[model samples]
Target chain A: MNIKIVKTDGDVEGLAEQKWVYSPSVKTHFFHPENLVEDVNGFDDSDYNGVGAVGSPACGDMMKMWIKVDPKSDKVVDCKWQTFGCASAIASTSMLSVMVTENGGMKVDDALALKPQNILERLGGLPPRKVHCSVLGDKALRKAINEYFRHSKQFDRMVIEGSVMVDPDTRITDRDIEEAVLEGADDMDKLQKKLKVGIANKDAYAKAEALMGKFMEKYYG
Target chain B: MKISSQVNKLLKDHKKHDIYLDHAATTPMDPAVKAAMDPYFCDKFGNPSGFYEIGLRAHEALEEARNKVAKILNCSSREIVFCGSGTESDNLAILGVARFKGKGHIITSSIEHHAVLETIERLEKQGFDITILPVDRDGFVNPKDLDDAIREDTILASIMYANNEIGVIEPIKELATVCRNKGVLFHTDACQAGCSLDLDVKELGVDLMTINGSKIYGPKGVGCLYVKAGIRLEPIVYGGGQERGLRSGTENVPGVIGFAKALTLCQDDKDKENKRLTQLRDKLIKGLITKVPKCFLNGHAVKRLPNNVNITILDVEGEAMGLFLNELGIYASTGSACTSKSLDPSHVITALGLPYEAAHGSMRFTLGHCTTPEDIDFVIEVMPKIVEILRKISPLDLDSNEVQEGHGNLHYK
Candidate 1:
């Protein structure tokens, strides 16, 4: 059956039919012949700032989303994937990859708003029962973005050198600021003492302390 | 006359004899069998367990029916244990043997009807190890694999005489021999094979076997489980002392008579009936293969049941085909109706290693003594067009442009 894609941002308008034989396990990704392409390239492996992967073999879908953030701009500059699932699965991942890449500087909030229904409507429409299949890709995209941030924290610890002014003009490396905020604070009282530490160009440090205070009270209190 | 409208509009549109291509599910009651049952329902209805003269007559008639069933199977009447249906008979054979020994392992195939597989699975869950033998592409289980799979812990091996879905007959004699040499109990769910194929319990060397009446144009709700004279089994369903105390149900007198008559009739005309069914089955199989592109037959071409023609058509959903055919007043089924709502294909199809699309498209046409040439002709004429129409509206393809825009309004008067 032919699928005529409708020109809507979030609503897909066509129904496409593919003949798929049922198999025992729904875990592996199946690729159609016409859409097979070479892997995405052009990103430096060392520059890979973050990566996210999610979904489950139990659910019969899995997606590994890769993101490379430019150190200078603090933005996601590149993304790609190797997804394992059905037609809706493959389509959703491919669409999520495009959306994430287009919004290179998108905050996590914008990325999470990528609804599964929007993915379905974009691909025309999925079989009513198969709408749930779209959720795997959308959740995987958000998870990959979260993972990228996690990996970025680790990379900053290893590569970044110094802290900048807290007053908002200076470029403060994520690691240096974090290290300074954590420095000399062995116990809660030391952190509280540092919270009271007054220094020139310390707005960023103070802001960092406030954030850490929120985390500490939420977790340890 | 567009396709979707044609299906959605028409429910029972024709006066042609409703071709029931679902005999593997069950066959219509034969008149002769019903006639035999009539006497028991009227005067011979007294309980066989009673000591009075009328009861004695009922007892005599029950024995006679059992003897007739035994005669058809070439076994002694003492061996037949009557039960509710093919499934219950299967439960008795598999679970009875397993429960008798109280501890041994079992070996079975993946394609066996749930009557065997599900019982074996329950045993597995209860600490009994099970080796599920696999079938070849033709839906035949290899005897060598049975031999190789047998272990010291193995107490019984149960394989179907013929697959209910694909119609492929198993190598029962060979597998039975393997079980015999290993000193293990062998059980064949001969529910499908009983009416169509010759059953010589002595020749096959099976310790236990299962057979059903409804499948052979007998009444539903009654079946037979054959236990060899020497082998002992515990009653899984306990109750009154009946059927030699193995199965305790008050003998379904009418059902027993009908079952015996059906078995006798099958045996009486085995040669002629098989010939007739094979001719129609071959015609249907060959016609569908030649006319339908991308269609793959699902079982052994010649060694299958005489009346089974299972084919997997590419690019069309079997469920949709079933729905479309239903619109045409055609009665056909896609393998198992058990998991139809789940959108997953039959587990039997998956066990055969068929790809997802082909499994989803599988359909079984089981002919019976009642199936006619006209019915075959009607199916052959309408099936291809149905497949074409369903495939045109299928959404599994990536390159299709016709999105099937409207839901309905293309009504046919």
Candidate 2:
């Protein structure tokens, strides 16, 4: 005796039902984000050696992070963040803040080594599409580490070479073009609007466009 | 302050209540419609094409449903073609007309559901000329614009009777009149309008119209297309030659019965129910805007559907808000459920000239037969607090004085 099922748009028999299920930890952190900094007014610039922000509001995800370090120990004493994103983003940022500041904070070098997969492991997991959200906190932390080195005047400690503002006064880097393209400002006009690339400097703009074209081919192809 | 107090009181009163406000996606079957369809599914089950007595009875029942639909649309029963769903009806209307003519131009608005939009896109890929007319900020296509878009080779103009996302009812009669004068076939995907608006095809002057069952408290997977008697269409599917050879398959007898019964019930007290829904919808809209600052309505205030209240709260993600509401016993939608899985902003909302942030922040609440003023009150009471919570955490609100001045600085967690 065999039973047959009819496949319809609204299948009442529930044969092929699937849904995106967020882990309990993700739900918990999303509903109540930990160590979120709502106002940055009180935290003075002198007290924090590193400040980093990444993502864009126009692209639907933005995160701003600030870290306070102990001078003698060179450890992240406190970490806080603000974000405009979906549940996964908020949850990931919250978990990252806790991870960095827990046990009297992690060493600067160790914190920079944190990856998105580590954060996802701590938070149980996220949906496949939301795995990108985990990257936000890790990227912002790297930016903060680089900022820390730059602020301390220890240029040798700066590891990641990120995009720099393109102008006649500033040197244009290949990383700058890559960053601009990744942010969806691929064309010259968009690059100018986003990063002010080639503004008042024809040589820089032309160089940036050529590098951007190569990066687009390498990454997209 | 008054709005906040009202919300607080409602929250205290109905903390455990479950309210559903996403009726535009689909509605529960009406009991009468279910009853009408029950016999056909089991005891009265028979092939309508069979020559025996039970089969003849099923055939009569099928025709009776068609007649009921035709009478409502002021068309002959022969003109009504039942298919699987509204998407199928749309495909048949657009593809059918285009294939019948072999090659020509077509005009459609930018705000059509993906069914019409994707169908036109396929035709374009197949070497057919297609013109997508832009809509005004209010999601309305100007009649003169449609007239101007029609070329000598234009074969059809397809516009939706009402939008599913923003709920803006189009000027269908005027648009159809323009197509008629230009000697072009006019089609409207009236799936959303069947339960709320007039269905008189003669009054609308459209060459074709599409209707769906699930949207009107009927069973899903059954839809109808009203093709004018003289218009010829090439069938997309070839099979047992059911549905006048345009749609080939065994007819869904139970679904047809339920659809007809649902249509009759919805029309029975539509005016009164619409009035009730309109007042509740307006109250919800007004309360949300006044209580929750920095929010705006999406579509035309007056020309929109009676049951729809779509609003965008600045600096908030609609999916997050929807999840928050779902945590409570309340259910709503950020946009069409079909496209909600994708993180991209709603195309309909973005077409209205809203920025990406605002489009991503839009939420739609549609009322239905079971909606009540109390449900509206509950939503109003809880909505402002939810918006406030989400807004406090939103990084977009950091620069706005409203967030800074109103909250007196952000509370660090």
Candidate 3:
């Protein structure tokens, strides 16, 4: 009258199997998002040191991050986020929130140093197609750091401007070259026409083209 | 002894408890069809082209299967040409006819399966003029639009019987008649519709129709193209001059037998089963809309397939929902499996004029003969919790006025 169900090692594995098309760490964070601000009203107040948002619903992925910083120590006191995206995006942002707030919070500068690879590594890994999802979290965090500087009137602390260079004479930037390639300018000549790169300095044009080739491999690959 | 025990353990643990709802993607083979195909694999195995008695038997079995399919389709047996799969049948019909005519115009809908759409795209690259007709809000193509788009050089028009994503059935008879009046050969990919609807090819007035085995509980890798008599088609894959030189490959006897048996079994009880599936479909649709707020049904209310229930739950990614449902042993699809991994949203959902968010949030749950009312109840019971969890973490919750305002500004910036 007693039904004895066998429980083997395989059965245990089946029970603990990952269900999502994501790594185990991603599935963990997606289902149990750490420091996820469930209520927008809770974080939309003036107490938040900075708020950063990236992506758009129209683009099928969006993220918003809020950080509370301790003024005395210049460290993040709490970090929270909300995201509308696939499992990878939600998990990436969730891990970002936890990473920033863990261990008594990262220093404002240290949290800004966090990269997409750091978040991705914490979440094990993402599908190649979904690695872009991890980028949103780091981008949003950097935006929050910039917002903090802008609000605190510490414009000199911003470091992103230094990486984005535009030749003063030619008036072209790495961003311009990247945008040109993304907008269907494939070859060097097409990029030259689109950005007018060699008009002033021919050496700068060669440098810009080489830089764009590297960016293409990094982004397109 | 150790390996044997391990094998036993693995076998016992691998027992499936899933309540499959992705029947539109494919179906498990019916037992009757499997039984019919068993002999062909061994005892009766023979190349239909061989000159011996065994070969003649296989040839006869192949002909019998063709006749069974033709009977259900209300077409002559000679018009039926067996092929590998629905995709292959579609490729043969589109590419075959287009290549035979050398160069001309082709018309298809924005919602056609990739088999037809991609084929037409390739044809376009080869100097053939192509026009992709748009669908209405309910994913139905307008007959008037087809009539207006027909040109003097229009050689062929391919439309789907029912959309695989939204499940809305097109007005095939009317659309085909429009093409007929304009001297255009019309083709319909009826792979999704063969089991759920009456597919009398003569009544539908399609010059060419595509039907597959796996969609109707037969084995995969077998389907047929119903080419109306006297329609010229060049061979896409030339080999043994099988299928009367139109298909030209060694006949797949076992797959053909299974397909025929499956089609007969499906046609025999389709009316009663369709009624059951429609009731279950309605219950699931109604339960989801009532339980899950900010959710709406996709596709037409009554013009869709009886087995199909597609819905869009706002502010949640369909892939996330699908994964959650999978944990509860409910297998479903967010969109066409072929395009699910791609970054681009479903073209079929987007073609219905839905906004980007709604299209990104669509899920399709197609029912079948094995689907039951209890399964529907289980899905209804669990779906709301999943939706609530997803929406809680979602950045955009339109129900909250403050969140909507915040999201609007963020979007604008």
Best by DockQ: 3
Candidate 3 backbone collisions, by pair: none
What is the Å distance of residue B201 in model 1 from its true position? 0.7
RMSD of each: 16.6, 7.4, 8.4
Rank by lDDT, highest first: 3, 2, 1
Candidate 3, residue B234: CA error in Å?
1.7
Q: Would you give the TM-score of chain B in model 1?
A: 0.92
What C-alpha lDDT values do all the predictions have? Answer: 0.67, 0.79, 0.80
Which portions of model 3 miss their true places by more than 4 Å?
A: A1-20, A43-45, A159-221, B1-17, B336-339, B399-413
Candidate number with greatest lDDT: 3
In model 3 chain B, the worst 10-residue window by lDDT is: B404-413
Candidate 1 lDDT for residue B356: 43
Best by TM-score: 3
Task: Please tell me what DockQ candidate 1 reaches.
Answer: 0.02
Deviation of model 1 at A103, angstroms = 33
Is 1 or 2 the stronger prediction by TM-score?
Answer: 2
TM-score of chain B of 3: 0.92
